[model samples]
Target chain A: DARVTQTPRHKVTEMGQEVTMRCQPILGHNTVFWYRQTMMQGLELLAYFRNRAPLDDSGMPKDRFSAEMPDATLATLKIQPSEPRDSAVYFCASGPMSSGNTIYFGEGSWLTVV
Target chain B: GESVGLHLPTLSVQEGDNSIINCAYSNSASDYFIWYKQESGKGPQFIIDIRSNMDKRQGQRVTVLLNKTVKHLSLQIAATQPGDSAVYFCAEKDWSGGTSYGKLTFGQGTILTVHP
Candidate 1:
């Protein structure tokens, strides 16, 4: 079955380390989304891309977090000087913008920053 | 600003019993709504969704009810099983502009505990 794929399903890093998470959306999907899930906040949309172009990233902290879609197949979220508060499950979802607009989610990358 | 929240933070139901979870939203112009079920350590999975034009939608044993006048939403799970125990979130679509199709604003989740 075709589904959104995420790399480094589990990441453990110390504070101040640079961490990058990758996502491969399902083929032919035109919309890609990045979301962060934590105990305090459920699923918050961090960034959104349509047709490999960034449309919105206001939810992301500009200083330390960056999200980009270099091409149609790949999307990445990077965190520099990752802090302990950054520990959470980050999810990548993909779907079409037409009718229904049902987005399918990835397994998520569980990050633990100590 | 749109704010979506749940009426109850946690609800416990016995196995095989029917469960209903309620949600409230501040936006009345919002059109699309979705419900997601998330287990511990996992991403949220789509449960069911309803457009503003419709009042109710059913999928399998799950049902979503929307009331636009009061800005309320509810999920009804029939024959609740242990596998159905998880946190449920109600999300509303915020159309900032043309690029807001897949952008969803999620609400505080309701925890469902099914006891056998």
Candidate 2:
């Protein structure tokens, strides 16, 4: 099936460590999104890109978090000096840039920072 | 910041019964809305969506209802089964900024428990 693919389905690390998650969006999908899900905040959009160019990342902590689409087939999210509060299931989604297009999501990467 | 929130935090329904989940948003210019179902340890899965111009939309066993006047949205699952248990979220696309980047603001999810 032509679905979004994410790497390292699960990750465990200590505080102050660096973690990176990778995602490959579906082919021909020009828009990619990165989201984080937690018990308290639910699902929040961290960042998004259109045509491989980032449009808005206001939801992300600019100092510790960064999202990049190195290429059309690969999008990466990295967190440096990760804190325990950063632990959450990070999801990558892709779809068109229309008003309310259906976004296809990958199996999220679960990260635990102890 | 603009946000979407749910009315109920959790819901329990007997198997073979119908299930209804509700959500509310603050943005009046939201033109599109979508419903997503997320199971434990997985990403959210798209269920259905409705446009501002339309009041309702239906899928195989699921239906989405939108009330633009009240900024309320609902998801209805017919013949709810055990497999239907999940955290359901309603997302809206607010065009108030005049941008169509497909960015969606998601609501706090409602945990649905289906008991057989």
Candidate 3:
């Protein structure tokens, strides 16, 4: 019954504002991923971390978006000076270190930038 | 510019009937494939997965078939229920430049509707 938990399930902000989304991964899970879902783009992976270290962030917007796993339990995605085009559902998923691991997802944080 | 895709955007079926959703991947080097079900407004849930080495895999009432020769993947659900109505996405894992575990590339997805 373990699940990944995300905070601020819904967020509304004006353009140029800063938005922060938090996630609490399943206890003992080591891999965390952040993804954005939009009607046009579908689901796109933004970043991923393993063992509290950042593994990849190439998919993320280099200028405004950043993802970090501050500790084993908490991971966060932040957008500074967020734009209207950035509005979408942000999902956090966590999985094991083994191959063919099943990534479990959180309910997701819905963000709307006006 | 490369992408994975579903054969159909939508499919409708009866309650007792079986449903098949198909996906085609452009990457021949992909070694692993996974099927995920996403309910409206929810994240994708793991349904089943198959490796390139295997042609077919089954679990519960669901079966996944992989045709590597054609680069096609399908999900078959027996006795489709209302709860089984959701968007199904096929994802492929390809080896990254230096990463140990491959990164997942998802298909556009197919929505399934089961009617009683």
Candidate 1: the clashing residue pairs are: none
**Superposition error at A96 for model 3 (Å):** 0.9
Q: What is the TM-score of chain B in candidate 1?
A: 0.88
> Candidate 2 residues A6-109, lDDT tens each?
98899999999999999999999998999998766778899988899998898999999999999999999999989999999999999977776788899999
Per-candidate TM equals 0.92, 0.93, 0.92
Residue-by-residue lDDT tens digits, candidate 1, B13-95: 99999999999988665788889998887778999999988999999999999999999999999999999999998988755
Best by DockQ: 2
Tell me how far candidate 1 lies from the true structure as C-alpha RMSD in angstroms.
4.0
What is candidate 1's lDDT per residue for A1-114, written digit by digit as tens? 999999989999999999999999999998899999876676789999988888889899999999999888999999998999999999999988765567888999999999
Model 2: lDDT to the true structure:
0.89
Decide which is better by DockQ, 2 or 3. 2
Better of 1 and 2 by DockQ: 2
TM-score of chain A of each: 0.97, 0.97, 0.98
Clash pairs (backbone) in predicted model 3: none
Off by over 4 Å in 1: B1-8, B96-101
Give the per-residue lDDT digits (tens) of candidate 3, residues A1-114: 899999989999999999999999999889898989887788899988889888888889999998888889999999998999999999999888666677788999999999
Candidate 1 residue A75 C-alpha distance from true site, Å: 0.6
Q: Name the DockQ score for candidate 2.
A: 0.52
